[model samples]
Target: MSIEPAGHGIEADNALDRRFSGRNEAVPDEAHHDGRGRFYWFLIGMRGIFSLPALILMTSYLGFAAFALDVGLTRSEAVFIWALPAQMILVGTMAGGAHLAASFAAVTFSSIRMMPMVASVVPDMRNDKTPTIVLLALSHFIAITSWVFATQRLRHVPRPYRTSYFAGFAITLTSINTAIVGIGYGVVSAFPPVVAGALFMLTPVYFISSIWASARQPVVKIAFLFGIVLGPLFAVIEPQFDILYAGIGGGTVAYAIDRVRRRRHAAGGV
Candidate 1:
């Protein structure tokens, strides 16, 4: 792929786009890409420092580090992984003497949630000139916060700049959180259960607000709300599969409702 030159004005950007626009076949990502583009997006991505999600994440992880201490983990072990769920599962398994196979399975299932998030944002972030490998590497950094930010904000960014923008943001966020975990490990270790629980709740509150803010379609909104409401009822009836049941059952019902609505709309329009 002929890498486009970024950090230039809009006219230069447009010129590069026109020059490369006709090369339709997929090319290796950024084989010829340069430092200027990377630097530009790095600056752009670092803006997350002041974002609400980033602040909330830093606070939540501060609380989570206390749990890591309880699990008998080193600061290095806790800082090694970025995803909270994966870190929790792997650390818990290690502490509980769970086998490698079981730990792997649990982590994979936790990662399954990332697939949809990656699918939604990555394509828009990539161009034909982008390397598939870059996309793959960037996918590793896409937790719920990054995914939500990218989906909601990246579309407004120039397409060619999207991947770099994401790389910068994700890298910065990861680095900051890792530092937070490492530095605050001892300080937060003695946090009481109530305070830790409250800090943990911050992440979910952000998730709920973000999902609501990002949902453009009524059907999508209904599915999210359905899952939220069904969760408690399902928990009472079948605790083990409450989340699974709430998710799949709610999604299936919402999908069916959407199809019927579409059909009715088609018929009524005709």
Candidate 2:
């Protein structure tokens, strides 16, 4: 006779149940769901004021200034000659055909990674399509830092709110990025090379730090470590193909390891 969890309607033999049982415990109270909601809203509100200014100043001073140096222009010359024109083009092109094309490409590429996340959360959403599409659209706003933070710090949030929380996070980040790009053009000339370099380091450093902090699963750790070690080696061989090779190579390795582990566990149980 088949057995099931009493009153829960879930079968005892459900693979999903087994997976959840094997997963880590929920996040603690200091990182509670309600507190995270408050923080998320706070970040959204801050985006219009403090975040925008900081982003603009940093991007202009760091990214634009660094680009200037790379092209052998003095800071002033770079700002006036290169940065200004570039900013103008970016802003102007936002409503142009190229911008639309780039946006479509970005959306298409982003959807590939996003679909898995949506699928994972679909049950939690009770198969609600409206919220799913809305959240998917909102996901375009997400960058590495917010994703890491949301995944690590907001474990208590019900599945439905996770998308909304991510939406808020992405919106805040997008505003900050836009503001930074705008401000960076004007102020890049005033910053010294060292200061500019520091600014340029922000995005990369944040991404690395977030990944290190958020990666919990053995499979993820293996994939990431392998990707890191193999990425440069492959890049040296063919820079354009490095990412493709690393993803396929690392994914295959991880899948093989998982398969072996599962087989051993099944054998042991038998």
Give the best candidate by TM-score.
1
What is the lDDT, from 0 to 100, of the residue 128 in candidate 1?
72
The all-Cα superposition gives candidate 1 an RMSD in Å to the true structure of 7.6
Q: How many backbone clashes does candidate 1 have?
A: 2
Where is model 1 more than 4 Å wrong at Cα? Answer: 1-38, 192-194, 231-249, 266-270
Candidate with best lDDT: 1
RMSD of 2: 11.5
Provide TM-scores for the models.
0.78, 0.55
**Candidate 1 residue 261 C-alpha distance from true site, Å:** 2.5
lDDT by residue (tens digit), candidate 1, 112-142: 6567668867676888778899999999889
